[model samples]
Target: MSSTKDIDALIEMMAKLPGLGPRSARRAVLHMIKKRALLMIPLSDTLQNVAATARECLNCGNIGTSDVCDICTSHKRANGEICVVEDVADLWAMERSGVFKGRYHVLGGTLSALDAVGPEELRIPKLMTRIADEHITEVILALNATIDGQTTAHYIAGELETRGVAVTSLAQGVPIGGELDYLDDGTISAALKARKAL
Candidate 1:
């Protein structure tokens, strides 16, 4: 009805993105419009290209522009070790750290009984196949700390145990900059339990 109708729609769509609220979306849209030539056009073209090409990797379920992601295809990644994560974001986070030099398996989500999600719904079967086909000897569970995450980790551990694969979990402890006074009781206990013997 108004001249700003298209701009309003754009703002609404951007607001639906994970971390962007209506106010932030409005600001972002306005900023983009001001830098239309430098930012908006490139962003629009890139979004379209990625939308057309992006797909989940056949091997590890990581989002990529091909059947298998680069990480899965890379010969340098340790073949015997696979990091099992709840989502692609977690995989990316681990990559950012540059610590684990191995392939990753994105489970899509945790096993949720309330939501009726199970191993069949996730990529657990695919993971088992990868382990056997790749001759994997170790699996590092990088799941979150939620109840459902723990349940899924335990279930996967049980499955891998029968296959004679060594299953490990990320050590839960105080963060690099976290203060003990600000941490929750569970974190304190986990950190204490995982303490080194130095």
Candidate 2:
């Protein structure tokens, strides 16, 4: 058996994580090994705990350790407005800016006909229900500016308009094909503040 088999396996697994290459993964594993007590052990325990308890929020599709995420359960977030995002990362990005006071709705992905994805595949139906049940007055479409994202936003806007809810989208600060997770806090705030009706 290879002497470094376990370490190599760990690097391989880490390499599969987003934005990590094999070389970066190896460096990360080596760093963790050098700081085993301070970083590796605690990281392992935390990862295991999160893997065991993490789940999608039943109400808004955010990931959390419970069936419903903290944001969805917070009464203070019930401001009759919902910011719709393509992923949980985007939702977290918006929250980090601390500009929006309303709640969020995470659409797992955009409508992609080429990829065979449709509204039914995402959380659109649930959003419709939330609009009615929560008496939502406005829905802010914070989707990315990609083709699929824009298509999904338009579809959602049309749907909400018929329900008498005002729909708006982030301004042109977001470059085409740029994702929310990549934008800085100031840019997110600017886009949101200058949002236009859809």
Candidate 3:
């Protein structure tokens, strides 16, 4: 039994992390202690470095270790198109797919009436500003297929309707590997409605 108040405090803080509880935090702390040379020291140094340097890009809301993110500053990504996503996770997912070759605008979150989240709360104003500033020609709504997501998309479309920009959305359907038997009624209906010639 170590009398290290600092270690206990660290465990408490780690326990507060998303998806990590007290038990997992304790186990992780113990494992980190055991692998101090291999993991703990490096992790501490990296966390400190990131804490000191991590910042949101001024142009976009993407998190990076600089004033501007790599994507925003890259000339190759200036394709006159902007893909709009709700969160950074969605941006990362689009990046992982390697399908899009344009700039991105993160909305922070969807417009939620229940939660009282509005356009101002997100980066909507910034997005609108970026449209003219970046000389964007098209705005792709890559939001999730939820009710709030569609509402937000429609609101954005309406805003951009007169801005001389083409607005489009991802095709709605069952997922690539989704089984028809396992799909919900809404999924089935959407897939049927969005069906095209194969």
Candidate 4:
């Protein structure tokens, strides 16, 4: 067997990770080899543990080591509000924002007619069930600003219309303290369309 075979295999595997290319993976593997005790060993052990235990939350589709995520299991987070997001990353982003106090529903992806993704493919049914089972009073659509995102929001809004749940969208337009000079035309138009009475 070649002495570098296993190391080459490791580099190949690392290259498949989200942000790493072959060149970067080689550098990362070399760095790990240099820091074997501090980073490599611990990282390998953690990766194995997560690979064995990490799972999608059954209730809300969040990624965790348990059937239900910590947010779903926490009594303090049972605030009767559910913020729907397109992906787990979006949910994490909202959490980092620290402005949303309620729980979340991580739809795996947006509804896509081209991809033939329907409500069952996502978590629409589970969301409706959660609304009834958890006594959800409001559903805040936190989808992205893309067409698929808005389409998904409108679909969810229609589903919740007669259920007595208040549906709201994320406010559109420029970001906090964003300069108009740096804004695009579409953003400016949306801001004007969403203008408030104040």
Q: Per-residue lDDT of 17-65 in model 4, one digit per residue for the tens?
A: 9999999999999899999999999999999999999999999999999
| Candidate 1: stretches off by over 4 Å | 1-3
User: Could you give candidate 2's per-residue lDDT for residues 1-198 as a string of tens digits?
Assistant: 252889989999999999999999988998999999999999999999999999999999999989989998899999999999999999999999899999999999999879998888998999999999988999999999788898999999888777998899877677678899999887788789878899
User: In model 4, which runs have C-alpha deviations exceeding 4 angstroms?
Assistant: 1-3, 196-198
Q: What is the TM-score of each candidate against the true structure?
A: 0.96, 0.86, 0.93, 0.93
Q: Kindly give the stretch of ten consecutive residues in candidate 1 with the minimal lDDT sum.
A: 1-10
What is the Cα root-mean-square deviation between model 4 and the actual structure?
2.0
The models' CA-based lDDT, in order, is 0.94, 0.92, 0.94, 0.94
**Backbone atom clashes (below 3 Å) for every candidate:** 0, 0, 0, 0
**In terms of TM-score, which candidate is stronger, 1 or 2?**
1
> After superposing candidate 3, which stretches have Cα over 4 Å from the reference?
1-4
Q: Give the per-residue lDDT of model 3 (tens digit) for 103-182.
A: 99989999998999999998999999999999999999999998999999999999998999999999888999989999
Candidate 4: residue 161 lDDT (0-100): 88
Q: What does candidate 1's lDDT look like per residue over 3-24, in tens digits? A: 2889999999999999999999
Residue 170, candidate 4: Cα error in Å is 1.0
Distance from true location, Cα of 184 in model 2, Å: 17
